[model samples]
Target: MYALNDIVEMKKQHPCGANEWKIIRMGADIKIECQNCGHVVMLSRREFEKKMKKVLKKADSDK
Candidate 1:
């Protein structure tokens, strides 16, 4: 499961060559921001889950 502020890595890298993304929003859809370039993207929950490779850091863990 993912939560807002969670840092995750997608199976594929972003255009900026970054695979790390920070979860900014969550719901039926999820919003992620690229850690390298500050690019923001939105994807459906199902799609996001499918593409997600691993959870690098949990939002709560950072606290």
Candidate 2:
């Protein structure tokens, strides 16, 4: 399961040639920023789930 600030890879690489994205927002919709180009986008949770390949890293948080 992914949450805010997690870094993830998508099924397809971005046109900018980046496959990694950082989660910047989470809710009914999810927002991510491209790791390579600083591009940002928001997608529905369903879309995010459909496109997400795997989470590369989870956000660090104090428990």
Candidate 3:
């Protein structure tokens, strides 16, 4: 499962041509920032799940 600070690959690429996003916030809505352009987007959990391809990097839990 994806968590805060995790890098995830979306099913589609952002306008900046970045396919990777960093999870910033989570709850009923999930917030993601584009790695290339620093663009932030908020999506519903359901929508996020549908659009997310996979978790590229899991967040370090040992912090």
Best by TM-score: 3
Quote the lDDT for 18 in model 2.
88
TM-score of 3: 0.93
TM-score-wise, the better of 1 and 2 is 1
Candidate 3, residues 1-63: lDDT per residue as tens digits? 988999999999998888999999999999999999999999999999999999998889536
User: How much is 12 displaced in model 3, in angstroms?
Assistant: 0.5
lDDT tens readout by residue for model 1, 6-41: 899999999888899999998889999999999999
TM-score of 2: 0.91
Off by over 4 Å in 1: none
Model 2 bad stretches (over 4 Å): 61-63
Q: Rank by lDDT, descending?
A: 3, 2, 1
lDDT of 2 by residue, 1-63 (tens): 988889999999999998999999999999999999999999999999999999998887524
Per-model TM-score, in order, reads 0.93, 0.91, 0.93
lDDT value for model 3 = 0.94
Considering every candidate listed, which one attains the maximal lDDT?
3
lDDT for each candidate structure: 0.93, 0.93, 0.94
Model 3 is weakest, by summed lDDT over 10 consecutive residues, at: 54-63
Predicted structure 2: lDDT: 0.93
Which residue runs does candidate 3 get wrong by more than 4 Å?
A: 61-63
